[model samples]
Target: MTGSTVGSATAARGLRWLGRWLLRAKCWLALLLLTAVTVWWLSQELILVAVVVAVGVSPGLVGATWVAASPRSFERLAAGPWRRLRWRRVITSRWEAVCRDAHLAERRRVERRSLTGERMITESWRCPRLARVRTTSHAMELIIRARSGQTVTELEAGAERIGSIFDAVAVRCWPVSGSTVAIELIMRDVLITPTIGTEPDGLVVDTVRLGRTQAGRDWLLPITGRHTLCVGASGSGKGSVLWGICCGLAPAVHADLVRLWGVDLKAGVELATGRHLFSAFARTADEAVRVLATLAEVTEQRGQAMAGRTRQHRPAPSDPLHVLVIDELAALTAYAPAEVKKEADRLLARILTQGRALGVVVVAFVQDPRKEIVGMRGLFTQTVALRLRSGEETSMVLGDGMAKLAPAHRISPATPGVGWLVEDTGSTDRVRADYWSDDQIRQVATRFRTGVQAVLITPTEPVDRQRERSRRVRTPKAGAA
Candidate 1:
């Protein structure tokens, strides 16, 4: 096995970089074309008049298209026995999107979408295109009112899905009610990540048996601090999962590369136990505030240092150090004052946004996931949700993508020492990681612990940013131009 040629294997794992770049380029081009068309159409005085007249003559006949020339036309399209029959032939036409929803801001009350609908065309349109091709537009809409004390973020999140897939539905929540969201896009964007150690349990540790035979099967796959999300309710082995990550990452400390920083908000009670492995930790909101303020300074210093470096080795992935881990990140938000918490969130966001290339990999754990905790759950390259109260919570934590990632594995504080590890497969393939004990955790921590190495936290991880963007912009290799 040691002599095995792993070049192709490893390269295959990383092919997503190219695929993503192509995809992203395609999206950028598509967006540009749309904008240009919109501008050109709007710029033409006569064309604008014609379009307005087109809309006025018959709303049903109007062909309202996006500036980007996307195939979104409000035409008088319809499906009947003949059209439906024809559609069956093109039924398998690929439709996809890489959907991303960021938490713009939280809303007070969330409205419940009214659950009512029938498959009768309330309206229709026929799209006029090359060869006079015609396609009809269908409407699917539902409305939900917000309750007095419900949160708006939850409602919109639910509504976004409703409008996109179930029905063109809207759920209004409290505060600024009556807002509507349309789900017209489907997810085509796929996130691909290199699968680091295939050894079972390598993605996570703590449960790796202490023997060569069964233990090798439990190799802890390091998430590369690439991006990890640890989820577990109050009692559900949140600490245990952290132990697993720590143990898996232990091999990196000696590289004079890996640097571990933690935000343990159990006032250092739960997370403090790992202090031997952690370089520094923020135990309270005040400590966190100070940590981030210092980190901001650190960022500038590293940026300067990186900027002055020679160009020959510019952006070498190995030049910058490796590793940045955050434990109990949400606690920083839950405990800090609004002003400080905002800054804290900003710092964490910065890490997630740009911590990759400086050889900085991030892993953050949170018990309860709110929109504000990490904004969009999809951002995390990999997720290790130990267990939560409900499937809704899990869906919110892992995105609907994890709908079939095994039934919501409920974990209570009593069972807090175990968790279910979910890696981003890009497609279908499921794996699981088991629970470990404190003593087992300590043993690995002791073995992996090494002397301190100052982490020069750079502001920009250029290589990471580029590679990540590429993965996000992948295009089909099946000969897509």
Candidate 2:
């Protein structure tokens, strides 16, 4: 029995190794055959045809063979060039068909004699010029220059029509320059499924992997010098984003290297599942306001302490990093009572403007992101918009120009956790937040419960009321009658 098990294991390993080698050898084999054919054609004394073909295919052949031993490396190296070559053919064929079918092609002019005996011909219309083709990791970008009499607006309006002809997942168009336009057809959907990853150790101070981009790149959110705002409708996966942040910071919470204050105005039901992971938690409007005021005071104290000695603050247990996570921000900012709303606004504004320098940051989630509703929206530089109702709302969360580029509104309802992240640099990427099962959340909360040294802040109550509650708790109940 032992010999049989060993033989089976050995056979599996051999098959995997063989598969890897074959994947590498296929690209090399194609290059070798092309090289041999070019040499044969050149040896047959066909000068012009052989010269043109050899010059085009030889450089690629050399590069592929150099990386032939590593299958993954070869795939990465070949992907860009192969896509560029393939897209050129696809564009030339499909674009012409589209132009003809749509009656967008220019007609040739013929000379005609006028009644006054002078020959005249009308000017012919010009076709859109293909400026260049750029291949990204998962999509192809076409840069086009408009003709003399044509406008980029016409091309932008027809982007969807062209996309339908190409069978693309999504089509995006924008002006690159005054006279040029860029049309990108995303051929792949990297975020169609929920990506699974383990909880972060939180030893690293400022980095966390939130999800992945449409290009299969890790979307790392940096919290040291930034604040994040996530906007998504109900059932649009806001919970996933919130818990992803907590899970990534759980280890730091356990170590006391970081402190968390949670304000879930939804009666603490959303964040209560991971209650053990936070230092202080607030459920009501009053409690949330109190927590914000305390955080603002702490920021002020930290700033005063750093005034004389240092200009920058470093995070540690003595003066740990502070993170304020608020779910349903509109309840505090827009829907609270008049007095509580005013106080909440005053305290939150103070924290948002002056907290980053003192190692204090906020991550807030909201359903509506209108400027009037979230008056302090300008303070958050990192914004994530997920599955919004319309393009207007998408622009409200991600910015005006991002509505068409990122297309958060077009996100299918079937895909809940997928969203687009807009950076401070005005670049946009589609990200799918990691989903945590109930069991996984419980496991993380139990494994990384806050320690004894953690300080918790709550709204102060009257001494008599607290004594009465304690007496009631200590009083024993009578036997059943």
Candidate 3:
């Protein structure tokens, strides 16, 4: 090669090396500055250096002590910020790879000309930009601006992959705006520990404190004018949620501000223990239909009375809020005899449709959330989904697209009460209901029993047998004579 060509090649190589070095100059500069500062500090007098070191280290030592003593306080004050900074760096550094792997990045091809005038095509990936990172005690919230051709649904679909890459327990994504999405990385499972339910000191008619949310806030379920549907697989703590509501409304039940009507189709085994807390208890399909019919009638009566007077029903001593608790809704709606099922469905549809405004609400629990089983599932204003069997069931219970965001099916079987709460507004929250033991349920039932008891109307004996018995009693038996 000619000397001019050789010189050009060497210069090209040197420029490439310098370009690579400049890319990492910030890190190298920071390291060098830190080292220089350390050396200069060590060169000072021993006592002065010691004082400086102590002053610098004291905050860390105190912070460690605070973490050990009061982790909650430390988390709010110092640990949260530290985690935000650390996780922000980690997530930003891995953003490209994660997005690419999850198919959330758009690939572009660009044509460029080489130094020799040759054409070349290169591939480049454009990923969603991380706008912000916020840390909570057990989670990290990421706000990301979507790249071209990216949608919130894409982010939601890749939430599981993103969570796995970040070693998070779970990830939830929601749209913040037209071009922005917010993702929450659950770093820890806060619902592993069971929360204990306590009886309210005074009457609580508006809302019931059922358990604790993933964010460490009290999970208050609104009860006054809302219906709730609890769906979960067998052994998924459906009873815990049922009893949590009962326990929370104990004081109100005793004060006559609320009345519970329980229907336990499994031979009353589920709700029989808390019979005292219920004004009406049904163990048979026929009895359940009767109770539902009664509730429907009451709802209609209340509606007529308040048709023009008021739009809302307020609980009073004379007119209490009627809560119909159905332990196994499928038994009444899906598995019952044709006649019984038709009547039960008709009555339940009436109550669920019109009862909210009349102070009559239903809290139904079922293992299966299929539309065929509970056709009126959408009527409930609030829904709680525990460890469901599959994503399909989660979607059925909450709504479409909720399976990706809530993922109740992914909940550990060991954590029975852990689930996701979906409000009517389409917002979802991770929550766990307090486990109410049999002893606790009995205590609450006995302590909060209303003075009135339910009078169940059941089937009677045949008229022929009754007449025979009456004839025998009237004619005096031969042996007695």
Candidate 4:
């Protein structure tokens, strides 16, 4: 049995090699024949004919070698036409029916004032014009012009209806204009179930790529001069966002331009997995209070140092940027003992309100983003709301009236990493957090771990004591006087 298995495997490999060699040979032969014919017709000089043939055959040989080197690229190029054919068929066959069933056609009656001020009633009939349907490797986009008197809110609200009509994995709506909406139908749920690739590279001190949007745009979080809050339900992929930020800043961490401080009150279950990447991490409420205190002290020291000297703080190795990442913020804010909670709140408020300009940032994750839970929610300049339990929860995390439009509460559990990001500009985007598995985190942590740990200056330090001692030493020359 072993011999037979080995024989079959050898045969398959040999066949593959022979087939590749034959393809290269065929290309060479065809190019040689064409070159020979052209040379024969162009000139009778044997030397000129030889030169032309040599140049032509050389190009064919190079081309064949490159083609053999990367077979996957050639296979993808070959399959492009068939993929487009199927995409066109899907669009032509089902678009109209799906739109109609999703209630995109206006069928009701509405009243309008006439030019002469007489009221007139007319059929409120206007169908959504199917402008274009484009298909890509990841998703299909349906651009439609909303009919008269229709708004993007109505179209966005109908996203699930349209998704159900077409049996898509999910649907997202982007309002291109007042009367134009671009609906995206995700054919497959690839965002939540990504195959691990090369570890994500890090960014400069102040930027972090949270993840990519459903349309494949990088969703960057500018942690410079801004605070961020991430809220999601359990198992909704909030951890992915945390690790995404870590991976995006790993290079800076290694360079000592960034110092990461973590407060994982869950006994270090979620964040301790990447223990090597953090400069300082706290696993208990008392330790968390101390961590925040150190950050608050750092913020104060920088503020005094920059007082009246500079308007904005610049990051440097002398004062590396400090980022305090807290998992389950409610544990520190609402669930801790009264003493620890009070101090934690004060330290956190100090950091959020005054730390950004000093290069001290915070990225806090919570399962619920109620004001009662994180009372200083307004202090955060950026917020990302993932899958939630209710519309009110979404609204609370994002803002009022966002629940109906973005509808984060309605996000499917199967698409775990999907969420909505609200920046300081008040613009909202639907994004998916990158899936970072345990193995990927370990690999990145091991690669970027530095031996140097960050040093924090407290309010009381030996430098001040040294200054006082120098003053005394200079004054004690009474004998010489």
Per-residue lDDT tens digits for candidate 2, residues 1-481, read 6988866665665456555555767776576567667777667655654665666555545554444444466557765567667877788766656654534456669898899999999756456777887766667777877767667777776677766777777666668877788777777787887866576765756877778767566778887767889998888888888888888888888888788889998889888998888888889888887788788878888999999998767888777888899999999999999888888898888899999888899999999999888999989868899999889989888887878878888888888779987655445667888888777887898998877333435534436679999999988889834
Question: How does each model score on lDDT?
Answer: 0.46, 0.78, 0.83, 0.78
TM, every model: 0.44, 0.63, 0.69, 0.64
lDDT by residue (1-481, candidate 3, tens digit) is 9988876765665455445444646665465556556856778566655555566445545654554455577668776777767887888888899899877888899999999999999999999988987777788888988887887777767777888888987666677888888888888877888877776677889998888877666888999889999999899999988998888888888988899999999999989888899999889999897788778778878999999899999999788999999998999999999988987887888898999989999999999999999999989988899999899999898888988778999999989888997755455789998888888889888988877666654333436679999998899767884
Candidate 4 residue-wise lDDT, 1-481, digit = tens:
6988866765665456546655757877687678777777777677877777777556444434444455456436643445656766876787656666777776778899999999988874456777888876556788888777877878777777887766776577767888888878766555655433247554476677767766556777787777889899998988888998887788888887788899999999999899999988889988888788788888888999999998677777666788899999999999999988887888899899999888899999999888889899999888889899999999888889988767889888888778987645344667887788899888888988855665643323336679998899878676785
Instruction: Kindly report which residue stretches of model 3 are placed more than 4 angstroms away from their true locations once superposed.
Output: 1-85, 88-133, 143-165, 177-180, 425-428, 454-481
Q: Compare the candidates by TM-score and give the number of the best one.
A: 3
- Residue 171 shift from truth in candidate 2, angstroms: 6.9
Pairs with backbone N, CA or C atoms under 3 Å apart (clashes), candidate 2: none
List candidate 1 segments past 4 Å from native.
1-222, 294-322, 372-378, 409-424, 428-436, 453-481
1 against 3, candidate with superior TM-score: 3
Tell me the number of clashing residue pairs for each predicted model. 46, 0, 0, 0
Instruction: List ranges where model 2 is wrong by over 4 Å.
Output: 1-137, 140-185, 452-481
RMSD of 3: 15.4
| Candidate 1 residue-wise lDDT, 75-152, digit = tens | 113223334335323322311110112222233343343457533333322211111112222221223333334344
Please report the candidate that would top lDDT against the real structure: 3
Which stretch of 10 consecutive residues in model 4 shows the poorest summed lDDT? 454-463
